[model samples]
Target: AGLSEAGLDLPPMTAEQRRASLELWQRRKAAVLYSVANNLATVAKDHAAAARVYGQLLTLDPGNSERICAALGRLSMQVGDLQSARHHLGRCAQSAPAERRDFYAAQLAVTSADWATAQRLFRSALDSNPGNMLAANNLAVICLYTGQLREAIRLLESLLERQPKLAIHEGLVFNLCTMYDLESSKSVGKKTRLLETVARHRGDNFDVAAFKF
Candidate 1:
């Protein structure tokens, strides 16, 4: 009684055809879910709900779509789900454009306190885009945290030399002043001059006025 057996101009679907049909259906369903998740995330501001929906979509599509994986990764991070963020972001990083993958991977590494990996990825990102001020700033911060003061100073100095007008340059200058203050070899006059420069750029908001040498 089936339509194929009844010869009603309908041919039996092959196994491959059936598999393709099911995959298409799943992809359509995943698309709908992705839309709903985005709406929940952006319009409703329900990150938890959006993450849940995205998790479901991942179950359907897995890593077949890089955008979906990247969205899930970002949403997971927003919800403090570092483990899930690492998983999804790792997959996304594998397929992301070369210019951006290292940046995304570096952020994930930071969440895990993997400073070495983060440094490497951030450096890679900067190497690919030398004008990436954010990457330079982040790498400099990591260098400072790890007590690589000379490297940190070099990074900030290079950035300033290239783009002195960048608003974030003030922060770099402040960090440089702090490093100079900590180094006994740096003369008091030099430190004072650095602090004055920072003060000029940062105005009254510069807190180094109370910092004792």
Candidate 2:
């Protein structure tokens, strides 16, 4: 009964037991309920119930409203409810740093298919954190799709130089190698260089197929 009230599926419980569990849960401290909400989201994958818990937390634990809003925004995004995501993420972004603020806005713009705004906001996100490989990858993808092949290649190449050990970011590496194929007849050499770089960091586990050689 307690688990069900905490957003889990289990065998049926008597109405009296269910009522008792609800009373017990209502008596739980905010911190305990917060932990339960986290477990519901992470372990049980009960996002809807977790979101409700977060909404309750917003009023119960007002001091940590920003953090709760951020978590709720992320969960809304995960469930593909962009309207809810925009509301919560916008609230979180108001107090966030440039990287987080613009990244959230960029995600919203991308969802709306506003590539120009997304590109600008993602560039701001990357500029605020030079080592942000995800922002770099996002910017490069926008450039690639907009017919700016050289700019796309340059962004990824700059990321490689800035954070060489990040070869594990397969998407960035794959996008860079893809641009190499598009921009040069001698892509094999470019791919070889990328492979060599990956080999240094990944040792034997690096997949040769990622280079598209």
Candidate 3:
């Protein structure tokens, strides 16, 4: 990967300047390549290799340890290693900066269906980044589960207005609009539009297979 970044010759500069630029570029490329390799290795079911790359990333940049640790925790959760996920996420939650820790902790609790913890963490995340749409959306999710339909609709609608690109948000919106409206399941046209929006934004992180239109 370093060799590849070095291959991209920029327009002529002083020999020393060119050499320094290339050296720095190669280091950046190597970091990116290592991260991508880690992602692919995890996808290929090569957990050991992926773990090594993640560990390397930790050494390469201590400032980014929080996110890398979150990634490791998520992967651990996926592989049925809940104990490991909790262990690492707990460390990250304890020591990470508030901006990152709040969201990461929120995600950990949400994925486990711990609505109470998720609510608390999402509120914390929102306090740090008041305009964080995902955190607001997640808080709405907690409201939905807790049978606060009117409030959930308010939050979900607000999230959609701000960030319309996430398909998963569209799915959540579809559920909320159709189920939680004052009219409940009676607003046929809005329901149709929601389903259509879901299809339009379909691909990645959302499986519309069960949505029969």
Q: Using TM-score, give the best candidate's number.
A: 2
The best-first sequence of candidates by TM-score reads 2, 3, 1
Per-model C-alpha lDDT, please?
0.76, 0.84, 0.69
- Per-residue CA lDDT of candidate 2, range 87-195, in tens? 8878877877655889878867866779999999999999899998878888999999999999999998888888899877676778888899899888998888888
Q: Count the backbone clashes (under 3 Å) in each candidate.
A: 0, 0, 0
Task: Give the lDDT of residue 113 in candidate 1.
Answer: 85
**Residue 147 Cα positional deviation in candidate 3, in Å, after optimal superposition:** 4.4
Model 3 Cα lDDT, one tens digit per residue, 66-171: 7678777767776777777887788788988768688778867866779889888898887887668767877877877888777777776665656555435544
lDDT of 3: 0.69
| All candidates: TM-score | 0.48, 0.61, 0.58
> What does candidate 1 score in Cα RMSD to the true structure?
11.7
RMSD, candidate 3, Å: 5.9
Global CA lDDT computed for model 2: 0.84
- Which segments of candidate 1 are over 4 A away from where they belong? 1-96, 167-170, 185-213
What 10-residue stretch in candidate 3 is worst by lDDT? 204-213
lDDT of 1 by residue, 115-194 (tens): 99999999999999888887888898889889898898788668766665443354555566666666556547765655
Q: Residue 114 of model 2: what lDDT?
A: 90
Give, for candidate 1, the lowest lDDT window spanning 10 residues: 1-10
